[model samples]
Target: MSDPWLPSLITETPQAGFELAIKLSRMGVKMTQPSDEIRKKLRVIYEDDADSLIAASQVIAINYQTVAAANNCWR
Candidate 1:
């Protein structure tokens, strides 16, 4: 199979940048775990856990901050 292609993190707007941050967060989880079955099993537990969800949002926000800085806040 061909290698996966990762698009540039650079975005044209803050909204888009935030979306990219979310993608980055998800990709990190996938790469770290690399097991769909395990992730699915854990999803059921985290789906309803407020603290877990909040922690996830925090990670995404951090990623957004990094992306924004890299993009110079879209100038």
Candidate 2:
């Protein structure tokens, strides 16, 4: 149910859309995926950026992995 006191336009706005991903108020705001053209453009723009970020972060991931000796309790 919508609030009767609210402006009518606010309630009607969402129906005009292309598509939405999610709408839960708690998890986060909704997002729409980029269209094919935009997705290609974004991939071109960020591919190098992603490679650099991965290279920058790889050492931390390597450092953070556990060096656990096998726990033989179950055997």
RMSD per candidate (Å) reads 1.9, 17.6
Using lDDT, give the best candidate's number.
Answer: 1
Residue pairs with colliding backbones in model 2 are none
What is the lDDT for 5 in model 2?
A: 33
lDDT of 2 by residue, 1-75 (tens): 333431221221232111111122111211243366765666576568977557535533332221111112112
lDDT of 2 at 58: 55
lDDT of 1 by residue, 3-25 (tens): 67556878988999998999999
